[model samples]
Target: MSREESAAQARLREAAAARIRAARPELADAYDLASAEGLLAVRARIAEDTAAPEHLAAVVIGRFDLASWARATCEFALGLDPEQAAAWRRSFTRTVFLAGNPDNLRERFSFAHFADDGSAAWTDPGPAADSAGLRRLLKLFDGPRPLPVRADTVVEIPPRAGRRPDRPPVHRELHIAASGCRVSDALVHLNHLLAEAVLDGLIRPGDTLTIRHAPRLTGLTDRFAALRVDTDPTLPGRLRAAAGLTEEALLVPHHRP
Candidate 1:
């Protein structure tokens, strides 16, 4: 790439980052939009995949909408193609995971896995992960039959004095099956469901969440035999810590619903 072309691409990336920051201010502290690494990583992927970085970048940035861009970027990063694993990892390093109330979370916060290499794996709220995430979940299974997994929690949404009247707390439950998946995967899946419930306004901070797995699953009872809110102050932290994290991973607080 020529010096002028490189500079132009950098300018476009800065503009794109600004656009994203404007749309989601809460991410200002979460991601370093000024960094050139993310743009380089993304551009590399585009170049490798299509060998037309400038054209693809123009098309994606020409008429950008936050939602569509987020969806496309995430889907591309999570593509099942084995050959793109390195590219996907690079893309993920620039992505942020958004979880909480879908309305606010999608429009606000960002999440990422802090890596030892100083890169973060980020994901934004896009398509529901139920389908694709579940497909990935299936890969973790080890046995023939699916093991039952359930997570329940109660949320107390305190009323605003003048805005609304006091209401009772509500209970929420999420159920899934793991066919001999590792205890860790099962816990991660439960955490995913819990995050979804939080997005749906069914779970909230300070709420106690309980995970129930089939007794037959070895080592599960030992790890999360009687997990509760008192034991784990932050439910989302579990998802952040479960996997895809390195020894140097730093835990950042997620938005509360």
Candidate 2:
């Protein structure tokens, strides 16, 4: 591209970034991170021998949305906490924003995260990409929504009669089976199973499920895991058969006491 053309593209990139900030307001940091010059340096480092960053960045950039992704992580805590949410927004922005940059398209350009525990982080592809990436990431965030079958469904355990409202209930045991399944896919499958049981009337409103052995639903939501997952994979099948349940019941918030 010519200098004039490059300048024009630069201006357009700035304008596009401006539009996104105005539109999302919530994603302001993400926009800034994507447009920041510092990301250029991060992209440069990936031009070394590491291919993991490039492929991983592509996988994430193709499916990440800062707003929704943070919510998915924080929702495990309940709703959005502005401070924690801001931290997450910064995390994803700093990590994947530039990994998806048009200029950072070198074969060596890849991705990495700052987390001590080494979890994956991604970004929504830029607005100039026609929002295809944004739409895809948003879809992942949209669900495990409410099951349509309503039965005054207070599936959660009842609050202690004299307990203080400030005190949250203790977490119930969660059984996590070992599997090669991706966390996101597993969540969808489990949600469907739960929905099936509820629809079949096998699960009733106000019912609290204490599944002794079950497969843990994995995903961003699992970060704020309410269920204590079991490491043993064999037990879940046994428990499912013993209970005559074709699906593993998740002790989600709905089942929280």
Candidate 3:
């Protein structure tokens, strides 16, 4: 590609990176962003080997919308059946992101994340003349059972009145089961939904967020812990830096920062 073409492609990546940094700057230090970059590099290598336009486009789209991929991961998990979800909870450990560059236009890329066991294996049919590389990733389980999520329904558990109710707020438990879905998938789905809700301004920074579920079979007490991220005003700036964006664009208020 010509130097001018490369420069144009870089500009497009910068723009997309800007959007992501603005949305979640605190994750700049997280390995997921770096892992995503590595995947993008791999896609580029595949593209160079094959010279496939369609493959390049697919790769770039996957990388450019990294957040969307994470969201998709949750959606996929949430749709699993109860039996499958429970099995996945015990078997899955790592969360992976896959990406590619489709058209070779400015190194554009896209990615999606999946939860899998550490030993899960994948095989790729090296770059096709018309494709990037045929990927055989770990297959995900089927969608969750047909259980409706009632957004307006609030299942209340009354606070215990005996203790120092005034000193420490009474804690009540809410039992929320996935709408006829697998337990593992429901947790992932809920995680992504909550993440998106926070990103979209629907869930405020300090608002109390809770996950209610039956402890008997959910196995969520441990899996759900990793999703906790304290939102700081400076987090967006950090995320921008992680994406190789200039820190000036973060624009967080000083008091909050």
Candidate 4:
């Protein structure tokens, strides 16, 4: 990429990182969990369950809103007064439309995977997402499903507050894009490590980052991402150590529309 293009890219990622850095406490907790032992256990379990990084990434970051909302409504059904239900309905509508798996439609799309190379693997949220979000929620409103008769089931549906991630899970894309060699492996490996850090909680989503992989004199390197992470030339080992990374993998950054 040209110097101008690179600079613009850097700015975009910076904005994302800034948002992540400035996140509220409740939302930050989820990002902070990236490095916790429990999250590590979750990652380990996920790795054991799948051989593909794509599968691992999916489990790490898939946004499961439909099911969560349903459970929440059921638990608070009796408490859902007319106004509360309307509010929830509006919230639920926006959610299901943007994030739910609506079986009612002949064709449905999802952004469950994070796109590393900028290839849009699914239908991302757009300008009309809110109106459509509500419509989609209404379709799935088949009254209430059969809840098991039980005493006081607990429900916790924390509203996803603060700045939401603009894209869905693209962890695999980032990993593959960053797994490169010494010629310019710095950015690639660092980003790959960052993805794990995100899953592990070392790096929060929306935190601006940059890569320092030196471009070849002959041409630009194959390192591209939706948001380029700024890196410190002195602290490569720090990132590696934090993410428990030992090897370097590489790929060219190519965003397919």
Candidate 5:
């Protein structure tokens, strides 16, 4: 990458780091996850799962409604094939929708998954791994024959205010695009972990759980050096445009709903 390109990339990482630190301080401290790396990892993981004919499920719960967050997610889902836009819809949930209650302001999108048991689990709001989650959980199995269920039903996974994350569940990293744009690090890992839990049936529908996305950086060379600070020396926006990242939704917003 050119010096200008490198500088722009650094700026993009800075913006991603800052956003993650400010928004997800807990994960920021633990995982040190960054944006670009996280998004790419998730895209790769989802693509792998979707390519499989078997059903796989996962949940992405965060401070939703931010156009940036939505845009980034939409871009990732559509990353594999633009014309195959419907592929994500079919692989995960069939709809691109949001769910929440007035009491709780969280936007969540869930994909599909199967449990170790014979049951299946989807997204629902009730208790932490409540019957709703369990009901779907039970559906994963084939008493006689297994069938995929893509219900149009909408349910809310009740709010659980205090929760924590299990550290180092799996390896995760961030990869900066040739362009400067970045996503969230912990967020991407969290998505993968969610998939595992869903597959394991540890998280049933209607069951609420806690997740964290700590901001961090990895794979920097021992001789790595900081970028020169001249004329701001960073242009994440321009780089994002250069990279296809410009087409994504507004990720993190200034205010909360």
Candidate 6:
């Protein structure tokens, strides 16, 4: 790119970064905002729409860039007391998982959660075979009233046998304990985990992912909802098929200063 073109790109990135910082002040120190290439990629993703900075920040956070997420979380935590840091971490983690691409989520399932009223306003997916399975899995949390309790979901991805013989399997767990949270939120969190696992190259074709969700309730038996998903090679292909992109495209090579 020419100097003038580069300068203009830099200016655009700076404006976007400033807007993001203004909206999400806690993410002001996020390394992604400081990255020229990262900002360029974010810009390219939303090139068609004149989205607000809050929406832009949501895109960045929902990108599931592990390195950037970890760095921002650590840096922000360093400035807070232990208790506050822990609380912030929980909130940040939930935001990262819940802020995923809504289009992708809608393609698979129909879901909605109203935070103000803690009321469920969602319909199950169509009567397809896969949708039937999903409906059955979600039945564990079915109740007349919203449960005011916490639920922990554990996702276990076994390491690819031949590719990474020495690398260990990835095991991740997340908790949905916030006030006014609902089962739909947990489903979104799970969907983000599956997408992130594929993007991170932690999950491979033919691998079976074991997922379990245990709700904490008093005076109730500790019953956990368990399910396994067998991933095919086309799973990754389907995810990347969006926007006619074969793989994640970057405007430029990303590197930290």
Lowest lDDT 10-mer window, candidate 2? 237-246
Question: Lowest lDDT 10-mer window, candidate 1?
Answer: 52-61
Q: Model 6, stretches more than 4 Å misplaced?
A: 1-166, 202-257
Q: For model 1, what is the error of residue 85's alpha carbon versus the real structure, in angstroms, after optimal superposition?
A: 26
- Compared with the true structure, all predictions reach lDDT values of 0.30, 0.30, 0.30, 0.29, 0.29, 0.31
lDDT of 6 by residue, 27-123 (tens): 5544486566555454454444334221100111223322233223222222234443233222222232233333444456544321112212222
lDDT of candidate 3 over 86-152, digit per residue (tens): 3223222122223333233223222222223211111111112322332232223333454334342
For candidate 2, give the lDDT of residue 44.
47
Clashing pairs in 6: none
lDDT of 5 by residue, 1-257 (tens): 67866665566565434433432344454443444566344435546753444322233333232222322332233222332322222343222122222122222324232121212223332222332332342222112221122222222222224644332122112111222212332223233323222332333233322211112122231111221111122533232311111111112323967
Q: Candidate 4's residue-wise lDDT over 109-138, tens digit each?
A: 343332232221222222343235444443
Model 5 TM: 0.21
Better of 1 and 2 by TM-score: 1
TM-score of each candidate structure, all chains considered together: 0.23, 0.22, 0.21, 0.21, 0.21, 0.25
Badly placed stretches (over 4 Å) of model 2 are: 1-176, 212-257
Strongest candidate by TM-score: 6
Off by over 4 Å in 4: 1-109, 113-118, 122-191, 215-257
Global lDDT of model 3: 0.30
Error of 6 at 2 (Å): 44
Clashing pairs in 1: 95-122, 95-123, 96-122, 96-123, 97-111, 97-123, 147-178
lDDT of 1 by residue, 181-220 (tens): 4443443344333332333233433232222233332222
Between candidates 2 and 4, name the one with more favorable lDDT: 2
The C-alpha stretches of model 5 lying farther than 4 A from their native spots are 31-257
Between candidates 2 and 6, name the one with more favorable lDDT.
6
User: Highest lDDT among the candidates is held by which one?
Assistant: 6
List model 2 lDDT by residue over 43-145, tens digit each.
3433453432121122232333322332222222222244433433322212122223322332333322221112223322222233345334333332232
Model 6 / residue 84 / CA error / Å: 40
